[model samples]
Target: MLPYSEEHAQFRDTVRRFVEREVAPHHARWESEGAVDRDLWRKAGDAGLLLTNIPADYGGGDGDFLTSVIMIEEFMRGVFSGPGFRLHSDIVAPYILHLGTEEQKRSILPRMASGETIGAVAMTEPGAGSDLASIRTIARREGNELVVSGQKTFITNGGLADLIVVACKTDPAAGAKGVSLVLVEADRPGFSRGKNLEKIGMKAQDTSELFFDEVRVPASNLLGTEGKGFAHLMTELPRERLLVGIVAVSVMEAALCWTLDHVHERKAFGRPLIEFQNTRFVLAEVKTKVTVARTFLDDCVLRLMRGELDVATAAMAKWWLSDLECEVVDACLQMFGGYGYMREYPIARAYEDARVHRIYAGSNEIMKELVARSL
Candidate 1:
């Protein structure tokens, strides 16, 4: 079991209540509307759920990474996917907190913590996904400003992001060494968002096409050292991948619980499903698999807190747990039989939401490549 202090327990309770009160009721509406309501972001901020790990001086909760973990686990337990809170709190906020100038942090992190400004990192372009070096997005320096021109697809929080950390090739001739990260405000003159994209899963989370047409920003908007963006991404990605593993294991745990509850109560062939030998065996396998996954996930979390989690171990955790999550959730859904196929059922939604864990945070294939290089 993971270590949890009394404070952590109280924080978990807070997140649980938030999920029940703010998320569970209107998620279906958000799903139908193709994105979550903007009000939810403000509410999450007010509830101290937006930036739990950010320092309190910056309007954050002054908590550790475990707080974010609790939020993910609680949300996934409810099959809640409408909000991009994880991407906002754990992923985007950290970029600024870690790499931005002190002035940038002083200005941006407080607004992000309060949900006044939503954040996104735009890295994947139309022609580039895993190949970060191949991106055609260019940020040409003009005197004291950088004019950015490119299109980014599949950006999380793209529809309502107030600030975006866009990855651009500031020195294209240097290949990977030329890449840079630039902070672009959403209302910049040439910046525009395409319609929210529809997906088979994660329907309620806004994913969109972002266009940067000569959007210019002061050179001061550069995040980290100019031309060091790729290395910066490498340094931060382990945490992001570990976050995906946390989500994967949580989904597996919840899926197993839903299946077990169904098997114990549902009658099949005039007998409770749990009484059947095959039913017992299937659940047995699932229980063992989930237990192992939980143990590994906890170990990874500990390593992360200690700053010992490397890219290889993180890649292993991301690819393996995500693959296992898909397998386990699929198995658990099978136990629900016809009911699993219904969208209204939580298990069905869990199945849909679990899919992208492998695809995002770097595809499982690229994860394997990273692991292979370490061998």
Candidate 2:
């Protein structure tokens, strides 16, 4: 609806078909296995579904940000949370594209585009979540090599990551200014992954703890300038937060549709659930809330395309829409009565998945603080 061209329309159709044919069938299996099949990434890459915004020279689809938006929207429409493609393409790839040197991009981005190598970013540590400045990961220089010593947890795609953009403290006394982004190859001697972490939701996505026990890499692997990692992260936060916003509204929209279908066919008292005044009122409220959220989401997406989106506005979108998503899903779940509690239902899975949106990409509380600082 946001001024999508004919190409966008066709792409959406392709994504919809792809999701139905490839993702939906195996999503339950992935959830049970605690990770999507490794081959899914290759299939997605072959379909031009990965790195939609990166340039063609790097083996990407040469599409814009809207293409990525279409991809996210279609995936959420079916409530399939198994693949970590969004994190792989939109989140982690950008860091490399924007910050890495030409040699880095030439060697890595093409393989990533081909899905031959998976990527992940390591930032969150056991003691540090929202407070990235407090992370204790140390990268000590030893001649031409850098020895990385620290642990990162809750890393998406960690188990399969072939390349990781690691956040390290190059100067411990300088606080946030001490942080630097170092690119570490996963096969390094001391680099290892813990078991895939189990979670309450998004069970099909692999999230794990990554340990760097003096993992070593060349000095040339440093991303951007030394001691500028926090600034680099700040430059990218708006996009990441906006991504959360995109997922939030997409899930809300899907949940509303599911609830609508259920209420129309489901019976309560002597008639359909939709016949009840209370049910009607709840649906009306949900519809209105979701409509408003969609409008705001579209505006933010347009701003992102125009390169005009600011940190505060992006923060508002992230926190507000994520909160609304959880609220809408909970209300929709309640409408299903006992059936909502069962895992067989899509709405139940949605209810479980809606929770982490508030906590990740900087918690909703952190988002509010960021906005307040701007005010």
lDDT of each: 0.93, 0.92
TM-score of each: 0.99, 0.98
Q: What is the lDDT of residue 184 in candidate 2?
A: 94
Q: Per-residue alpha-carbon lDDT of model 2 for 67-141, expressed as tens digits?
A: 888998899987798888888899888898899898988888888988888888899999998999999999999
C-alpha RMSD of each candidate structure in angstroms? 0.7, 0.9
Off by over 4 Å in 1: none
Using lDDT as the measure, which candidate wins? Answer: 1
Deviation (Å) of 331 in candidate 1: 0.4
Whole-model lDDT, model 2: 0.92
Model 1 / residue 77 / CA error / Å: 0.5
Local error of candidate 1 at residue 339 (angstroms): 0.3
